[model samples]
Target: MTTTPDPGAAGDDRRLHPWSWLFVLIGSVRQFLVPLLVLVIFGGRREDGVQLAVAGVAVAVLALLAVWRYFTYRYRIEGDSLFIRSGLLERSLRQVPFSRIHNVELRQTLLHRLFGVAEVTLESAGGSKPEAQMRVLRMGEALALERLIRHRGHAAGDATAQAPEEDAQTLLALPTAEIVRLGLVSNRGMIVVGAALALASQVMQDNLFRRAFDFVRGEASGYVASFDCGGPSLALAAIALVLLALALLRVFSVLLALVRYHGFRLQAHGRRLTVERGLLARVRSSVSRRRIQAWTLRESVLHRLFRRRSLAIDTAGAQLQGGEGGQSREPPELAPIATPAACDALLQDLLADAAWPPRDWQPLHPRAWLRLWLGDLVVAALLAAALCWHFGAWGLLGLLWLPWGGWLALRHARFAGWHVDARLVAVREGWWSRHWRFAEIDKLQALQLRQSPLDRRFGMASVWLDTAGAGAASPPLRVRHLPEAQARMLYVDLGREIARRRLRW
Candidate 1:
């Protein structure tokens, strides 16, 4: 008789599935609250109460459904594959082999934190979604499963049992002071300020900027009436109030940053990078070293003075866990705030063999500024004319902004350039804020070269770079107004390079 062990029984000894229903039900009820809130806001009391009763019954039904799903859902790891069975009515099944699993992600919500469990997803290299997910596993179980997958994925993705070695070294920690520094350095404060403004606007039923202007007008009127000040004094008082409002807004943003990035830490393992941070709630995420498709470095003029830069990474498989836009494809910040020297050290450690941001810059056409200057001047002139129409002779003062616009155009042109080598390509651009993007030539999916009628007159062509995991709506990088001949040569060279390299994905 042949003897074989059943892999489905592998985790039967210690696995727990009891809490999964609670977690799923909680998420469903949270979503259901929005409609109830709408009913409360707009419906009559009697109608609202009746609707609430109906909602309660509906939620009870959903709870029963969630219970059924929890009972049915089960997972087991055997040999080199994970088998998952879920869904209450349909009874879905997925068997993801270790070779197909690309990334293992662990996520926790507030309830998970309170209950000491987390959700785990096994992402395959297929596309944007995960191949299998196990919700509300005990912390220990989640971590154990993650480690198992990583250990297996490393060996399977490559030919042998070799995987990226894990150093398990802590790379960075944001102490109280550095956390404060991060708040000051990051633009995310804007998110907090934006949310505040949105909430306030909704409550007041008015735009925040308009509300501020009304407040300023009221204060200015009172000052003018009491002090007998002329128009200039009134203008100055109004400006003062506006400035005060702006200063307070800035402070609010910094505080928000402090709350969001508190207790942030970065750790590096052999081929994985992990980030942990949060205030009231905590977030922990991992990025595989091999999955990094590209990186972008960003710095503003203010960021330059502080010697600070932000780095973002693009990865394959699924979208990053958290970022500004909620679009999984957005390149989430890897090092949100850091010095140039620190970034260099971090990159060297993370991407040991990758030649990133090649320093040798090949300049764009000197006349690249021509289009920018003309474009900005046209905009400024249009604005000045509109001001004149509104304010009459005084509107001629608006023309003074022309020089400022001209300077911006000049600055943008000076920083626009690119560098290319056999393995890496670095693109630098921006007017007020500068950004440097680096990508592997082999990673590029496609390239496009085009010329507008104006560009044709100047014998210039624009080149757009396409890479995997970049969303369909926008190309990852663009170089505008390069000499047409050079652009063509670049196009051919890039295509050749893409064809030459072996694509691991």
Candidate 2:
């Protein structure tokens, strides 16, 4: 049921580990937990018999399938391609040419850590998920397979996929201290805590959390009935509770960062970047320099306070969703935390041949502040008025914080700038959370110039770019609220760039 970590285990051979059933068992439990929880919440004791029967059937089927999967799944390298055989009742054989593979990732879950095995995920272009996934291979073998695939991909065309030798230069390595810093700089603490609270809320009525909730709701006669508190005291108590929750969430977030980014390292091999990280579930993944579509530099409120930035790249592999990419799906990250100078260096290193620096930043329209923040200003005014109407003199305190929102709008206006160079285009925006994003000028799949009713009134327009497979959520680059002439000029320039520069992707 349990296995010890074995770092030196060789994965050069093609075989699944005997202990992979443990992973299967865990997976089955997770798959069932949500539905089981829902059933218990809805049916209670009345449907206990049906629940037990359904659970029993589900467990038995999952267990049998797990065993069969472990027995049936096998992966091997044959000549220039990787071959996989899986499934019991309906056997399937898949062969992937090295050229077609975009990325190969080695992921180790808690099970892999225990059994000294890793999951190998192969990703190709245009699919719902990863092309193929070989679970529970020895760590050494996984690396070897990835290296072989990289070599094949290189021989086929690209030379800088990855080099799994000992002499690759280390680009960045984050120690435990930086991981803690990353946790502190991240805003995910509250999200984790909120998720846990939501999970607690779904407990069965007879369960401990449910009982506690009922008591809090005055089910316990003395709980709320005996509460004799002034309005100010109640408000203070509510605030205290909120702070306590946030504190706990932050602690949880720190632990998550510690586990996730323990021993995180980035290495460079020619034109390839390799990343290895995680404490319990280690991952080793590599991306080609050419595959990267764009770069994003983010500085959250906490990050700004700490003077740190998180740099990430959106590669073809990150955007691609072929078949079942699974663990191979994560995007390449330069550094989770880095200084401004380090960021500049990393960006330069990545774009060594293309362009050195972008052109001078041209700011958005001067009246962009009114266009961007007018709605927020109206909402703030409405809130202040409503509060004053309800609480009279006391509500006037809301006006004290009104200036903060106005100041943030000013900050947003000041930070909004864009630049277009010979090879790259960049955009910078945001107030509390600052962002600077860059994309290749040549890779512009679509360029749009538009004016909304408000923009028309202000005689302004916006210009944005898109890459292949990129959704509306995050375009490669967008510069909003520019003057109509400037927006149209940039739009025409991009069209010329698209025609002049040959597209690689």
Candidate 3:
């Protein structure tokens, strides 16, 4: 007789189902208040006695049903997959295979922690939401489940593991010193300034500032009224000092957050890359070699001052979580950050022995800068003219913004560049500093080759690559001023890859 053990049975032993009593108790507690409140209102001596009894019985039935519903829900593991069976009226089954799992996120809410339960979210490549969420599980089981699924998917789209070791490319981790530096470099002071401004605006009853704050918070409107300035200049001075203090606090906060995530590390462990960072809530993110759709290394003006660059990965999967937009394929999740020069060296080394090719090319045409300049100038002029026509001299104050717009436009144009190769297309752009980024043809999601009337007049067009994981972030790559033929070819290539993936789906 064959002696193979049942894989499903082994997995079931490690599987967990939440305490049914928890759900039932939650339902019971919530239900208790409503009926009790109604009884207090309606209960009386003679006429309402029967009605009260009926209401009490109805509430008891509902509570019992809720308890039964909770007990009926169950989940188990089937080898490298998760199986869920849940229903009170009609049965339903959800199966999530390990290969399709994108991320296994563990969340511990306050109640969950108090109850010793952890929520496990199994995100997938195709689903709009997590394919499976064990809403509640013992902490131990949740951790084990995360480990098993991550380990079992070694052959799937993971990158860190498959990075070529023989090539001797530098792998980076944020050191304590660097992390501290990053924290210092971060602009946390701005946050404190903003907060103080908001509080002061509230006290002063500045509707404009209050509205701006409310907009960011995604809330409904609040009462707006003017404040009485009863205090004198000394009071104003004290307020100013408080504002200054708040600004300092914000700076520290930014530094602390940066330091916490500083010295970020990325290590290749066969086929997946694992990233760990946190000041408070530790985060571990992983990406596979095959999922790398494109790469972007960006330098802001401040980063230039420090001779540093921030690197972000634009991959084939959805963006890293906490993304607020409707689900779609997103730009790459950040792998690790490094210096600009280090990025160039790292790219060269990593792609040196790869099956596909890397890129080398010229910056965008010089005329591109002129186009940027004119676009900004035209926009400013139109806006100024419109304001002058509408609001008169008060509107002309807006035109004071022209010089700043011009500087920003020129800065943007200065940094935009593009490179071409048989296997890859790289487009680089930024303001005051540059980012060199590329996407391989096979990994392209969708291509938009667009020409506005102005662009056509200038014999210019833009090419945008819509890869995976844009989430709520800005687009991953956009190359303006490419030749029409080149844009067409790119569009066709990208379309084919998108179609292939759709067919697979």
Candidate 4:
């Protein structure tokens, strides 16, 4: 005779939310009905009443079965892992470790928003598989689950590393009003919303649209009038009126877009960064100081004229990772948190608060000037010649910038400089619009020393520090025009530190 498994062990493997199938059945039935109805309508050759009834019964039965299976789906927590068991005949179990969690994102779709449900997603860094996602969670439960994970996963040293609760000063905290102003100035929502409205309108008017087809085939458009214009002047007037209406609608769309995306705010509370934005659907995201991968400071042409800059942080795998960082060695992550001067001030304040020693300031090497100009000249000349050959006289526009932009690039490259200390590395680059990025040496992942053929001839090399996720696939801090030997020595030092401080996954 064989001994049975312990009841505790059996119970640990049990699942919850057996009633979740009710929602799933409802959703499946809703999804199946439209296609079934379409088939009934289009299969005109059949004796439809009997066929329709049989199909309806089949759909209903399948929907019921789906609902039953959904309700049977469950999950259980065992030690530091969560085990999910799903499917009816083809049952399976998935186990996820709490330590594997990198980020827990709560998603609210239109349906979830209406039902007050949430979708919880657990992301793992450098995982072999995609992140695990749990759907159909109540909002409160999802948040609670996320909090529990964070509490469990946070390192023991995290508490002591936090800035002093009593003495810590808040800096660069954006007021709600300022957030609103920035949102308006940025106008991202206006562009996005307008495109959405245009798409929606096109879909509604298209003949292939489901609703449009239904309208035409059913009694939905019986009273609609057909346009039969006889005069050119009246047609022209109508066209003009339509254009005017479109212009007014565009203006209104912009206003609506602005309202919905207003009041963006970012604050530095001790070592953590907090961002909150959106008018209708507010979002609040927070990250600890140590999690930040890089820092980016930017100024657009308009902002440059206004003497303002945006400060952003690059948190690897965060929202800021997709964009290109202008003249920066670091991967794009955080950015445009504030204007130029404000960002610089914020950086200074952050360094002081962290108790990190300041970096040793140094300008771009003198050889950098020659390299910049030579590279720019060669590139610009080739581009100009190509444009002229293709476009004939019209390519003068491209030719106009042959020397001008190249000269500017060279000038800017000369101004680019870097500084390093025992704890921090800061790189300053760009000309009229400058950028300053700073990170701790402990955060770096790798160091690269490079030498071009011309650079070898010049006896110079470029040094790059790969910070956290910054490298070939991402952005990193690169300082060009160092002596070859000097770059190698620095690379050696960085590699040694990287080995000492590196934490393996």
Order of quality (lDDT): 2, 1, 3, 4
For each candidate in turn, the TM-score is: 0.85, 0.84, 0.67, 0.64
**Candidate 2 residue runs with Cα over 4 Å from true position:** 1-15, 18-22, 37-43, 46-50, 87-92, 155-157, 160-164, 203-211, 214-244, 319-331, 354-359, 381-403, 468-476
Best-to-worst TM-score order: 1, 2, 3, 4
Candidate 3 stretches greater than 4 Å from native: 1-73, 87-90, 107-118, 136-139, 154-171, 183-246, 249-252, 255-264, 315-320, 323-337, 341-359, 382-404, 485-505
Candidate 1 structure quality by residue, lDDT tens digits, 74-101:
7777777787877776887678887666
- Best prediction by lDDT: 2
* lDDT score of residue 53 within candidate 1: 79
Best by TM-score: 1
The digit string of per-residue lDDT tens for model 3 on 336-453 reads 3456666666566445444222344555545666677776677777888899899987777767667787777677776666766545677777686566667666566667889988
What tens-digit string does per-residue lDDT give for candidate 2 at 411-436?
89998899887888889989788888
What's the CA RMSD of model 2 in angstroms?
A: 4.8
lDDT over C-alpha atoms for residue 362 of model 4:
75
Per-candidate local distance difference test:
0.69, 0.74, 0.59, 0.57
